[model samples]
Target: MASHRKTRQHPKALKAMTLALAGAAGATAFDGTGQAAPHPTPAQVKGRVDALYQEAEVATQHYNGAREEAGAARAELARLQDEAVRRTQKLNAAKAELGTMAGRQYRSGGVDPTVRLMMSADPQRYLDGATVLERAGSHQANAVAGYARRLGSVRQVRDRARTTAERLERSEAALKRQRVTIVRKLDAAEALLDRLTDEQRRQMSPGAGPAAAPEDPARSGAQAPSSRAARAVSFAYAALGKPYVWGATGPSAFDCSGLTQAAWKSGGVSLPRTTYTQIGSGPRIDRSELAPGDLVFFYSGISHVGLYIGDGKMIHAPHPGAPVRIAPVDEMPFAAATRPA
Candidate 1:
């Protein structure tokens, strides 16, 4: 009887076991479409984020150029406006003097000078006296010519100011659009990074990642090419942990090009504010010739720059979420190298 009871389990218990097995099978099986969604790996996310940041940097440079143009336009407009005011004042004074002369002539019954001369009994004597009048008339004509020239100049200035203002407005609009695009790209990159797990985030960080390993002493110990180079490298080193702020050329924060420009500036060198221009500021050199303080550019468009600190390492303000830090020189695609000092 005991053996029989063991073989014949309760119906509810048997059903429960069957349902549990079915659920387990369903969990491991394919979905309704018989396909699985692909999840991107951390490395894939990093690569995409890097690309987004690079695009944003390109837009940043355009924004900077527009800002410069707008500033210059504003200054030029102010100068033109001041000159116009001065010219207008001179024109008003000349018109007032001409009006006074017209009032005197009207008060004298508006007789034509030539008619009055012909009507004189002694015409030759009248003609001789007319020399003094001729000289005065010539002076008045000169004054009228001066007023006309000034009026033409004022009109030209107003036209130029108007043109410049219109150009500035267009530039401002383009800058706004660029800023919006940059924000969208940065937001997408941040969302990608946010999807990473805590361990993945830490792993992706330049300060904590395996890629951030220290450089070999021998490679990092090369001497600077000059005193200026040494000073530039030293300045970059002093800014190791500052936050990366777009368009900042600062004592506390910087973008990639801004950091390099500021570093070189501290060394008594003036570099262009944008990576594209900064790359052209010095003679190009081969990567094999890279030394401390040499400027290393990255990407096909040369949109990124960093100061080489020897030992196959470089100091740079990496991106918005990153900071001024040392990284491998080959961290991204190498485009060119330059020696500014």
Candidate 2:
């Protein structure tokens, strides 16, 4: 159920593709001297597949984070663009007003006050006109200054918009690359899975051990710190058996962070889209201090997350081919935990 926009091959199609690739995986490789390479044991294949799945999950997290950032950047860029347009309009209006002032002065024979006084038939009348001209000139000066400031503001907004636009472009490119990497890793992992027998595949699958409905936190002696936490824990339990979709956060499927975010949302606490960001969603807590509904992160990169459901166990989507299910909190490397209120 782990789906991506670009990769929508059904699970059955994926299985077939993997079986085809497994044939190639079993094919003997030739060295420069044409010697046959040794085939990998099922154990080695499982190790490689597990590593590939982890790598894919890391890439998926990066993609999710980049997507979140891109969304924000796009909104910021739009706001900056609107600001620039408004500033440009103001600058233009100032310019037009300054131009109109200059035109009026030209129509009135824009000559020096001293020359106008010398040529005037009535010198007192010309003096009065000069005072009015001086005031007009001051207004024009103010208009020019205002225009300069508006122009500067427009430039600043434009510069910021340009910078944000560039950042969005780079983030988009990175997301594309990360998407490709994830797809490739998932494909390879699936092929490796096909190389193993059903028993071997079950042995290597995530949440393969005793996956069942989680116990009630209150009854299991893992009391939630608050009603909100209890709601999140309950939401996670309801999501059990749903498929793991790399980019999905849904009623039917989810990725690791997606599951956590959705569960927390049901608790009335908004969480970020990726594990990296969710790590900072609330104050960090020690593993010993972990409570039901707390988010438990895994791996050094914080690429995976789970909703703690009490009794030292957590419910998570795990990896592809796994469903939303219960697993030990210590199943993977413990990176950190957070209690989002």
* lDDT values for all models: 0.79, 0.82
TM-score of each: 0.76, 0.77
**Each candidate: RMSD to true structure?**
12.7, 15.0
Minimal lDDT window, size 10, model 2: 111-120
lDDT of 2 by residue, 188-233 (tens): 9988788678887676564455457656556878789999999888
Q: Which candidate leads the pack in lDDT?
A: 2
**Looking at model 1, how many pairs of residues clash?**
2
* Model 2 Cα shift for residue 75 (angstroms): 0.7
